[model samples]
Target chain A: MAQRTLLNQLIEALRCLPGVGPKSAQRIAFHLLERDREGGSRLARVMAEAMTRIGRCRRCRTLSEHELCGLCANPNRDPGLLCVVEQPSEIVAIEQATDYRGQYFVLGGRLSPLDGIGPEDLGLGLLEERLREGLVSEVILAISPTVEGSVTAQYIAECAAQGNVKVTRIAHGVPLGGELEYVDGGTLALAFTGRRAL
Target chain B: MAQRTLLNQLIEALRCLPGVGPKSAQRIAFHLLERDREGGSRLARVMAEAMTRIGRCRRCRTLSEHELCGLCANPNRDPGLLCVVEQPSEIVAIEQATDYRGQYFVLGGRLSPLDGIGPEDLGLGLLEERLREGLVSEVILAISPTVEGSVTAQYIAECAAQGNVKVTRIAHGVPLGGELEYVDGGTLALAFTGRRAL
Candidate 1:
C-alpha cells in the first residue's frame, strides 16, 4: 500500500460510487490529482452543494434542489397522467427514451418483505392523497417487472382505483435489438400475453 | 434534461474521469445525491484536499503530498538501479506486479514529436544529472512498447550511457497468461527473436 494517508482516503471514498472498485477508484483519484485538478475542484464544489442543498421533491420524492422538482413544477407536462418509479434514476431512463410528457412519483424502493419495505416506506400514503385530488385520470406503474415489483404495482393499482383513476403498467417483453433466442422464458411469456392487435 | 442547475453541474464535472461518459456520470451523480450523502461529502472534501495539497515529487516527478515521495524518502531501497516510466500510474502497476526495490524517474509522457513533446519537456536533463552522479550502475526503461515508446527508450538509453551506466529495457512478448493463438504477430515475432535457452 502507498504510504499516503490522505490520498488513500480519497481513493477509498471514490469506491462508494456504483460500479467503481479499488482499481477504478485509484485511477480516478490519481487522474484528478495529476491531470484534472480544475475538474476535480469543480466536482468537489458541486457535490458538496448538491449534497447539502438537494433534497427529495415534496411531490415526487426525487432528489432536487427545490421543494418541487423541475418536472413537478412544469405546467406544460400533463397533470392528468402520472408515472410511478422505484428510484429517481429510473425517471431519467424513461425520460431519455420515451415521449411520456407526464409528472412522476418516486416510490424510492419497491415492496420487499425481506427488506421490510412496504407501502408506508414507499410513501404510498402521499400517492393516495395526490390521486384523491381527482386531477390525475391515469397512473402508470413504471417499476421493474420483478416478483416484488408486481406485488407493489398491484397494491398501487388498488390504491389508484379507490380514487377513481385508471391504472396501467409499463410493458415487459423482449427488449428492442435483443435476439429472441437470448430472451428469457418469463419475458417471452409476458410478451405473448400482452400482444397488441396489429 | 434535469433542470436542477447544481445537480446537472455535478454530473458534468464527474464526466472528467476516464471511461466515464454522460450516462455513467449521471448515474454516479444521482447515486451520490440519493443514497450516499455521507460518502459524497467525504469524497468532496478529500478531492479538494488532494487537488490543493498533492504535487509532483521533487526527485521522481511522481505525485506526492510532500517534496519527496515515499519511495524517494525511503533509505533502505536500492538507489543503484533506477526504473523509468511514463506516468505515476505506471509506478503503481509495476509495484503491484514486481518486487523491484529501486529508485524511479517518471518521464510523465512518451516522446511524440507530433504531440510537441521533446527531451526537455520530459526532464531528460534531470535524468542526465542523476546518472552523472555515478552511483547508479543500471537504468531500466519501463515505457510501453509502442513506436514513440521505443524512440523515447532509445534516447534515454543513449543518455544513460554518457554516465557509463548500463541501460536495459523490460521484456515485451506474449504475456505470461496469454494464449499463443490470440497473440498478435508483432508480439509473437518479438517473442520468437528473444527466446532464451533453458
Candidate 2:
C-alpha cells in the first residue's frame, strides 16, 4: 500500500479510467509530472471546469458545455436526416470516417431490459418528440449490432414511424478491406444476403 | 477542428500522455464527464496538489513532497544495500515484485548517448558521492537490459568499485511465468548462459 500522500492520490485518481490500472496510472502520473507540468496543470483546471459546465445537449443528448452541442447548434447540418447512436463516442467515429453532413441523436445507452435499461431509461419519449417536429425525413439507426442494440433500433424505428419518418439501420456485413475468411459467420451471412450487382 | 471550450481544453490536455492520441483523449474526457465526474474532479485536484508539492527527494532522486522520500527516511530499510534504477516507475515495479529491503537511487534515465545524455547529465557525481559515504556495502544495478542500459550499468559499476562497494546488475532471463516457446531469442540465450543450479 502506498502512503496516503498527494502523489499517491494523483496516481489513484487516474485508475478510474476504463482500462488503466495501478501500473499505468503511476506511469501516467510520473509522465505528466516529468514531461508536461503545464499540460498537467491545464488538465486539472479544465477537468474542474468541464465537470461543472459540461452536460447533455438538451436536443440531441450529446455532451455539451451549454444547452446545445456544436453538432446540434449548427444550422448548416441537414436537419432532414438524423443519425441515432448509442453513445457520444460513436458520433466522433462517424464524423471522422464519413462526410456525414446530417445531425445526430445520442441515445446515451441501448435497450438492455435485463440490465434495467428500458425504452424510458434511454429517453424514447424525447426522441419521439424530436421526430414529431417533422424536420427529420429520415432517421438512421447506427447502434452496435448486438441483441440489445437491435432491440433499441427496433424501438426507435417504431417511434420514428409514428411521425411518418423513414427509419433505416446502418448496413451490417463484411467490412471494407476485411477478408471474408477473417469475418465472423454472422457478418458473412449478412453480406451474402445483402449481395448486389456490381 | 474542435471549438475552443473547457470540454475541448480538457480533451486536449489528456492527449499529453504517452500513447494517448486525439480519439483516446476525447473518449477519456467524455468518460469522465458522464460516469465519473467526481473522480475526474478529484484527479484534477490531486494532480494540481502533487505537481505543486512533489519534487525530487534530495538523497534518492525519487519523487517526494519533502527533502527525503518515504523509503529513504524510513529506519526499517537497509541503507547498506542500494537499488539503482532508471526511473521512479521501475522502483515501484521492483518493490512490488521482490521484498527487497534496500533503499533506492533513481538514475532518472539511462546513458542515451545518441540523445546526448552524458554521464554528468544523469547526476553520476551525486551517485559517486553517495558511494563515498561508505555505508553502502552493495549497489544493485536494476537498469534495463538495453544497449544504453548496459553502458550505464557498467559505468556505475566502475564508480561503485572506487568506493570498494560490490556492484551487481539485476539478472536478465526469461521472465517468471513466461513460456520458453513464447520467449524471444535473446532472452533464451541469456537464460541458457546464466542457468542456475537446482
Candidate 3:
C-alpha cells in the first residue's frame, strides 16, 4: 500500500524538537489524526502566528507577543526584585512554585565557552543595560545547578556587583518533599552547606 | 504571561495519538516551527486534503486516497486469496515482512462483546457479501493472538464455512527469530500447541 505521504512528512517535522525521536514523532502524528483535529489546527495556527508575532521583550528578552511580556508590563510586580532564569520552561516551573513575586529576565541559554555560547549569545549585554537603569535593587540567579550554570551565575553576579546591585543564587540540594534516603551524596553536602539555624 | 493561545491549542490537540503526552506535544509544536516548515505545511495541506478526499475503499474497506486502494486496483495481486486483519497498522507490519501477496480486508476492530462490539460493528455483512461474489477461493484470518482476536477469528471462520470457502489462520505463538529461553510461559505453551515438526 502507498504510505500516507503528508502524515509521514509531519512526523519527520516533529523529530526536530528537543527530546523527540523518529518513533515519538510518528506516534505524535498518528495521535493528532486519531484524537485532536481542532487541537492540531490550533497548533499549526499558533506556530505560524508565533513565528511571525512573538519577539524578545526589549527590557528582559523574554518571549512576548507584545513589546513587553506580561511580567515586564505589570506595574504591581516587584521591579526591584528580578529573577533571572535560563529558559522559558524554567520560568514556568518557577511560576508554578509561586514563591517569588518579582519580574523576570530570561537569559534564553547559559554561557558554555566550549560550545561557543557566550554572554552576548545569552543577551547579557541587555541584562547589564537593565541593571544600569537603577530601578533594580536585588537580582536572583535561578539557573540550573550544573557547572555551566554555576559559571554563568558567577559571571552575572560579577556584573551585578559592578552595577551596585545585590545578587544571590537560588539555594541548591534536596527538593521539597523529597526523602533523605533518596537524596544523593552531592545534594546532601549542598543541603548541609546551605543549612540555617532555627 | 498571556498564553500563546493557538500554540497551546495545537500542542493540546496533537497529544491525541496513541502514545503521545503533553510534553511531547509541546516539543513537537516547537520542532515544526524551528525546522521543516515545508514538511509542516505539507502535513497541514495533506491533513486538510485527506479529510476532504480520502475514504474507505468500496471493495476492501481499506483507507483509500482514491475510489480503490492501491492493493485493490492492482491486477497482478491474487483476487481469489483475501487476508483479513484487525487494523491498518497490522497491514503495514505484514507488508514490511514482504511475505503476504494477497489483498487485505480491514475489520476496523475486533468482536469484543464486553465492549459492545459485535459482528455488525465489524462490518461482517460486507464480508459476507464479498464472499458471495465467488471471486474469493480462500480466506486467511490474520488477527492478533489476543482473546478478542481469537473470538473475531472464530466468528469469521463460521462465516466462511457457510460459504463453503476454504479458511486458514496465520500461525500463532513464538515469533520468527524468537529464542525459546526468552519466550514467556504462556507464549511458549501456545508455541508448543501450534508447533510444526521439521
Candidate 4:
C-alpha cells in the first residue's frame, strides 16, 4: 500500500513535534524532500545525537551531555546564589533575559501529587544536600505562580531555612507594557500588591 | 559557551522546518527530549531514511522508494484514466477526498517561465510520451486556476490532442461549502459560466 511508503512514515513521524499536526507534518515532509533535503538530513543527525547523548546534569538536574552542566562546572559563576526553576528550558529563558550569573537547579516539574509527582521524583534529596553544603547564601524561586508551584516553593524554602540560607521568590504581577485595563483581575491585584516605593 | 550545547544545536536544527521559529523550535526540542524520546528517535531514523532513499517514481514522478510508486504498481487501478496534479502532496489530498482509482502524473510545479520553470522542467516530455502510447483514454487536469496553472493545463491539453485522448479539467467555481456572498468575484463569474444543467 502507498500508505506504508517511507514518505508516509516520515510524515507520520514528524507529527511527534510539539505543534505539528497531520497536515503540517505532510507539508514538512514534502517541503524537505522537494526543497531542503540538506536541512532535513542535518536535523536528523543532530536530533539523533541529542536524543541518545543528552542526560540530566548530576549536579543541577538540567539536560546535559556531561556529569555537570556548563553552568555548574564553570567556577566563574557564583556558587553562593542559587536560582531554582521548574524546567531546563526556563534556565535558557532566564539566561537570555537576565544578567544573573548564579548557578541553577532544575526541578523538572512542580509538586503534582495527583499526577504522582513528588519531591523524590524532583530529586529534592539532592537539593537538600546542596543546601546543607553551606555554599549558597540565598535561594531564588523562579517557579510559576500556581497552587502546586507555591507548594513546591514553600517546601524548598523550608529546606533553605534548615541550612540558614535566605529564600526569595521572583515577583508576580501584570507584565510590563501591558495595559492595566486589559490586565486580568488576578494579575492586576498582584501588581497593586507588588507596587514599589519608586 | 552553553550556547553551543547539544540541546541548543537540536533547537537550531529544528528551525529548518517550514513554520517553526526560535521559540517553537526550543519548545519542540525540549518536549521531545523530556517526554517523547522514543518518538524523537523514531522520527530521526525515518526522516534520515526518507531523505536519502525516497526518490521519484519512474512511472509517475511521485515520491517512492522503489522504481514505481505503489499506485503505479497496483494492477487494480485503471491506467486509462490519468489525473495530473501540480505536486505529490496533492495526490494524497485527491486520494483521501475521492475514490478515483486511476493512475496519476505529477507536474511537480506549474509552468512559470520567469521562475525558470517550463514544460521540460515539469517532465512534460515524459507525459507526452505516455499520451502518445494511447493507453490513456482520458486526461484530467487537477491543477489550480492560477495564470501559470492555466497555461500548464492548456499545454497538457494540446499534448493530449495530438494523441486524440479526451481532455477534461476540474471545474473552478465557488467551493463546496462556500457562501455565495463571500465568494470572490472571479470565482462567482466562473461558477456562472461553468453552470451545470442540474
Q: What does the interface RMSD come to for each candidate?
A: 1.7, 2.0, 3.8, 1.0
Error of 3 at B163 (Å): 4.0
Rank candidates by DockQ, best first: 4, 1, 2, 3
Candidate 1: residue A61 Cα off by (Å)? 0.9
lDDT of 3 by residue, A1-198 (tens): 555444455666665555678767756655555456556665555555555665667878765666877778888888899999987656656887777889899887789999999999999998999899998999999998778988999999999999999998888978989899989988888899999889
RMSD of each: 2.2, 3.3, 3.6, 1.5
How many clashing pairs does model 1 include?
0
Writing each residue's lDDT as its tens digit, candidate 2 over B91-154 gives 8888888999999999888898899998887888889999999999999999878789989999
Estimate, for each residue in B1-198, the C-alpha lDDT of model 3 and write its tens digit. Answer: 556444455566566545568877766655564455555555565555544454567777765656778788888889889999876556666888867788789898889999999898888899999898988889999987889989899888888999898999988788789998998898999888998989
* TM-score of each predicted structure versus truth: 0.92, 0.85, 0.82, 0.96
- In model 3, the runs with Cα more than 4 Å from the true position are A17-22, A34-42, A176-198, B3-7, B22-53, B112-120, B145-148, B176-189, B192-198
Between prediction 2 and prediction 4, the one with superior DockQ is 4
Q: What is the lDDT of residue A156 in candidate 3?
A: 92
- Give the TM-score of chain A in candidate 3: 0.87
Give the chain B TM-score for each candidate.
0.94, 0.92, 0.90, 0.97
Q: Rank candidates by lDDT, best first.
A: 4, 1, 2, 3
Q: How big is the positional error of residue A66 in model 2, measured in Å on the Cα after superposition?
A: 1.4
Candidate 1 chain B weakest lDDT stretch, 10 residues: B1-10
Q: Which residue pairs in candidate 4 collide?
A: none
Most DockQ-accurate candidate: 4
Alpha-carbon deviation at A165 in model 1, angstroms = 1.9
**Tens-digit per-residue lDDT, B1-198, candidate 1:** 455467788888888888899999998888888779999998888888888988888888888888888888888789999999999888888988899999999998989999999998898888999899888899999998889999999998898877789999899899989999999999999899889899
